[model samples]
Target: MELRRITYENVDAVTSMSVRDEQQNFVAPNVASLAEAYVCVDNGYAVKAFALYEGDEPVGFVMLGLGYMGWSAPPCAEGSYCIVRFMIDQRYQGRGLGKKGMEACLEYLREKPLGSADKVWLSYEPENTAARELYHKLGFIENGEMCGEETAAVRDL
Candidate 1:
């Protein structure tokens, strides 16, 4: 699995990708996530949005925001980068792409030159067992924090 920048050429493909109906409440769609990335950028947070590709086919989306520099959104922990949005398309689920995609995102974030931070954070609905299990397998631990109704988890980078 590889991550490619979301560009005009692939924006539609990325935005059209959808998670399963059961996961709708747990994740924002790629279009909304891309919009959030723009809002975060306009608010001064460094941001990155990517299309997850398996070989040459787009299969998922990920958006990352660095720091709490946004004017309206709550800030991340000091200088941490947050995985603001992520989801693999329903068509691409159950093939281990989510794990590989997350690994790719984590690897990219680790080398990112935003503010220095020891951890990366993300939040998910508490009832989203799939997400909780996937994230746990990826080494993310719940920090007993809440982002609105979502449970927050962090991983040392």
Candidate 2:
């Protein structure tokens, strides 16, 4: 598998993604328009997007954005933290790819720098037990309390 920049060709892969993937994010608009409007390419946003391909076929995706210098801190920085949108193809969900995908993203974040922020943050619906457990097993600690079922989890990078 390989990770590459998201492009118009992959937008359809994103938009038409199954509900299992779609429920994680409101995958709206056509691929072309979404690509055109993405924040990842903005030099100052510290937001990057990638399409994961197994050989030549796009299999999944991840969208990550930076925040401040604190864990779950306010989001007003150029490259302090990363708020992520991670997803895997429904067909590949139960496999280890989701964990692998998040790990890949974390590895990418860890290479950013020493001061940009070392805490990795992600939020998910409380009912999404699979993801919460996946994250917890991966060593992400819950941030003391739940935030409307959209509890926040963090890991030190």
Candidate 3:
């Protein structure tokens, strides 16, 4: 599995990806995330949005915020990176790609691709047990913080 930048050539495929109906509320759509990426860039913040691929097939998407401090919820401490958005296409569910994709994201973040950071953060809907479990298994711990209505978690980089 590999994470590729969402270029014009793959933007269509990435934006068309969707999660299962039941999970629709858990993540923002790729297009919206792309829009946010644009806004972040315009506002001088760093962000990375990528399409998760397996042998050239787009199966998921991830967006990362680097050293960003614009959250309405208590912002992450300085020098923190956040997983702003993530999703596996409905067709790719149950294939173990979600874990691989997340690992890929973490790997990319560990490189400090956009900037320096000591931790990676993410949030999920309070009821999204699958996400909570996966994140915990991957070493993220909830710090009793909230990002909007979601529960926030963080892991050392």
Best-performing candidate as measured by TM-score: 3
Ranking by TM-score: 3, 1, 2
Clash tally, candidates in order: 0, 2, 0
- By lDDT: ranked, best first: 3, 1, 2
Q: Which lDDT value does model 2 have at 110?
A: 80
Summarize candidate 1's per-residue lDDT along 1-157 as a digit string, tens digits: 8889888899999978987787889888788878878887887778888999999999989887777745333344557778888899999899999999999999888887566777899989999998899999999988887888888888898
What are the TM-scores, per candidate, against the unseen true structure? 0.93, 0.72, 0.95
Error in Å for residue 145 of model 1:
0.7
**Which structure is stronger by lDDT: 2 or 3?**
3
Residue 94 local lDDT, model 2: 77
What's model 2's lDDT at 49? Answer: 66
Q: The CA-based lDDT of model 2 is what?
A: 0.62
Off by over 4 Å in 1: 69-76
Cα lDDT computed for each candidate against the true fold: 0.84, 0.62, 0.86
